[model samples]
Target: MTKTKTLRIDHVKHPMGLLSVHVFWCVAFIVIPLLFILYYMMIDGNGSLTLDNIKYLGSKEILRCFGRSLIYAAASTAVCLLLGYPLALIISRMPTRRQTTMNMLIMIPMWVSFIIRTYTIKNIFNDNGIINQLLRSMHILEKEGDFVKFLGTPGLIIFGMVYNFLPYMVVPIVTSLTGIDNRLFEASADLGASPWKTLLHVTLPLSRAGIISGITMVFVPAVSTFYISSTLSGGTVTLIGDKIETAFLNESNFSRGSALSFVLMILIIISMLIMNKFGDRNVEGVAV
Candidate 1:
């Protein structure tokens, strides 16, 4: 009989060394930066420990900016989910080659740096841009300064978020949908369930984890985005990220910025917790 050979962890050489490298990487990058933020959050310019930074969060303007950030993020996330869920389902239902092609179309924009993508959006929306030019050529506007005013608007900001983050929502949901066994879908249909009923009871419940993941991915970045608002809104609209950047860069208040950063983290955690609970309830309801 041939001898059986099996790899064992105990026999592996330098396992600790491999783990040490990972530990060092985490400490150098994640842990150290977070510690620095916490340290800065607790200190004033005089190098004295202070609670002023935490208290600064209670100010009206800051709170309003944070609220706007939350609203914009939620809006963008909702739109992405609404648009992406259907789109992902469509893509998942395609043949393999078509799926590959459609997926490439969706992901091609992401290959470029977001800065460049955002700049392209700015050009497309700004005065004297393609839309206005087309409108003017069609006799929609007679004067040069009579642009459609797409830039510097709340709609533009939300549109930008939807454009950029829609893929984040779509891709994950596609993955989840494609992973589902077709047998389950067929079984649902065989049980005399209508298409819509099967979709609600089977497809949606199976896709809950993907939906939650997509929300987390889209919301966290959308809520904290500064450059998108800055470039598109031309400083008219400000989100929490804009406030943090101004606190650190323009005002040169590191402590306040760090405190804001801490608060943003807490807000995201709370939002995620609520979303997770909601997802669990929905799945349970469907199951019952």
Candidate 2:
């Protein structure tokens, strides 16, 4: 009998030098900036700490902007969920080659600059632009320049939000769906469950993590988006982000802007907590 020798190597540990570099970057970029913002929020023009900036959140105009932000964010998130979930499911069911092709198609718009995409959409809805010109040419409009008013509408803002953020929702859900074991579906069918029932009972439960992730991704940006509203609404509509931007940039009121930013951060954190709790309950319910 011949004895065979086996070679073994010890696992390589992460370098302390690399870890130190990451820590240095985090402290310099994230921690210091956040601390500076907090300091500014708590201080007045006289350099004295005060609570007045935080209390300004209750003023009527600020409250209205905050409420509008919440509404727009919620509406956009709901629409993305409705539209993205089905699209993700379809994509998940495609063959490997087709799935790659479809994913590329879905993500192609994201490769373009976001500002450019918004500009393109804005142009399409312009009075002399494609939609209106087509409407006029087709006699949908009574005469020249009798175009549909789409540029400054609430519906248009919501449409822009959905268009910009739909990819965020779709990619995560598709990832979760694709990660599911094929045998689970077969087992459900073998147990006499219908397709719809299997989806409701199994697929949805499994996809909860992705849904929560998508909601976070969509809601945060939607609530804080100023550029989209500014460009698409032509300055008629104002979100909380717009209010913050105006405070900092237009009025040079850093304290108020910082306070508003802090409030927005708190709101986002609360929303994330609620979503996580809801997801946990759903997972528990499904397990039961």
Candidate 3:
């Protein structure tokens, strides 16, 4: 009792220091910029607070862009889920070493610059590009310019979004699938459930969290991607992101841009909330 020792907590101090740094950057960068954007969005040309900026959302062009963005985002998320879920399931069942190798290969595309990837896709789909050249060699195209056009189409833009954002969808799902208890599968089999039934009832239910996370990840970026749309659409399509970019860069109208940005942000928040509600319902259903 006389020989008491004090335990100095240096580990706690290191984490506290890291937390402080994180908070500092969050405030200095994210919070501050968002506040400034909000201010700009709410004000008039005279710097007086007004709703004119937000009211601009009622314009037909803005509405069309917003609608197109929603459609593209929804389609991309659906495609990613359809493609990624099976890939994730397959990868999760593989041997650990092989799983790692395959995952690494899947992720390799992400290491390159996003703009470069978009450009590469654009080139591949261009009238005189690889696709056309191959078709020409195979006599599928009667002449040089007679090839099927892929660029500047709605399908092409959707393809680009799916191609670029597929890894984001797969990684989270694979993580969730791998975390499922193997015994659950055994239990399902013992209960006379087929593999597909087990997957639908057990695996999918447990993996809702990852599906939600992946949807949010893919949808948000897909909605906001002006570069991919502009590059692949060849000016045939205009998304909300393209409008925002034009408002700021071409028109030099920060107020309009900020207003569009705020509206897009609100839409994203609402979509996320909806997905979260769906995920919660799935969890409750599974628990029951």
Error of 1 at 153 (Å): 1.2
Pull out the clashing pairs in model 1: none
CA shift of 95, model 2, Å: 1.1
Higher-ranked by TM-score: 1 or 3:
3
Q: How much does candidate 1 score in TM-score?
A: 0.91
TM-score of each: 0.91, 0.91, 0.91
Off by over 4 Å in 2: 1-17
What is the lDDT of every predicted structure here? 0.90, 0.90, 0.91
State the lDDT of candidate 3 residue by residue for 1-288, as single tens digits: 111212233546555554565677899999999998999998877888988887899988789889999999999999999999999999999999999998899999999999999999999999888988999999988876687889888899999999999999999999999899999999999999999999999899999999999999999999998999999989889899999999999998889999999999999999999999999987998798
For candidate 1, write residues 133-171 as lDDT tens digits.
998999889886788999988899999999989999998
What lDDT does model 2 reach?
A: 0.90
Better of 1 and 3 by lDDT: 3
How do the residues 1-288 of candidate 2 rate in per-residue lDDT, one tens digit apiece? 111211122224534444555677899999999988899999998999998898898899899999999999999999999999999999999998998898889899988988999999999998788999999889999887588989989899999999999999999998889999999999999999999999999898999999999999999999999999988998999999999999999999999999999999999999999999999999898788
Q: Model 3: number of clashes? A: 0
Model 3 Cα RMSD, 1 decimal: 5.0
